[model samples]
Target: MEQLANVKAYLCAVFGAVVGGIVNLMGGWSEDLTTLLLFMGVDFILGLLIAALWKKSNKSDTGALSSYSAWRGLCRKGVSLLVILIAYRLDVTLGVEYIRSAVIFAFIANEGISILENLGIMGVKYPTALKKALDILTSKAENSESVK
Candidate 1:
């Protein structure tokens, strides 16, 4: 049973990697796909969490599908695009894609964590130890990067 579970986990991870690889291949492995994938991943998780937690709350399609959520989504997209633009231009002027990629990765990680937390709020139990570890990891990473 343990072996079977391990195999299943491995297969899932492999499959996800393959799909992500193809997406990167087709999308030219640019920052665009990375950011877009991160957004979509978070969006799907958020939707799932909302569905799970508010099954009876008459989830009006307005905010999420058309109004507030939609607006917020657009704004996030704009902000992401602006950040990417700034990073790209800075890289072009300074000749350093590394800096550009770092900036984008920071934004992506921040957004990803928030999405995961939102999902957890919807009844998904994140182990306290795991959460604390991630918090420490994130803090260290941010601090290290900012200090340099």
Candidate 2:
């Protein structure tokens, strides 16, 4: 048991170091990045619940849980992170700071909209004003992306 515990500790340390290195490469952690990650996680969980519990996921023809759809969603999230990483590198190259934050905020808005849509599919009513605000944010984010 002691040997097993030691091995586990060693593996955990290695994993932490790797993750920390990657986070550093991705412009370290900030409030915006944290919020974006939170929104992404919530959106993913809500999507799974909508598909598994409510059978209302529009990603599938049967409106049920689909491994393919889930995998695709995960892939998209990964690609989004990659885009953020690219934005971070751009900011570093240009000697500016807004690029990564802008990308993260855009992703946050997208994830927020997705979460709201999942809630709507689950019959969770929300104010129209809130939806409109998110729509506006998404449009603005898109416009900013196009400007680059």
Best-matching candidate per TM-score: 2
Stretches > 4 Å off in candidate 2 = 127-148
* TM-score list, all predictions: 0.53, 0.88
Task: Give the TM-score (vs. native) of candidate 2.
Answer: 0.88
**Model 2 Cα lDDT, one tens digit per residue, 1-148:** 9999999999999999998988898999888788888988889999999999999888999999999999999999989999999999999999987778778878988898888878888889989898887788777777766776
Indicate which candidate wins on lDDT.
2
Superposed model 1: Cα runs more than 4 Å off: 1-28, 31-36, 44-66, 127-148
lDDT of 1 by residue, 111-131 (tens): 657666665656667667765
RMSD of candidates 1 onward, in order: 10.0, 2.1
lDDT of 1 at 48: 48
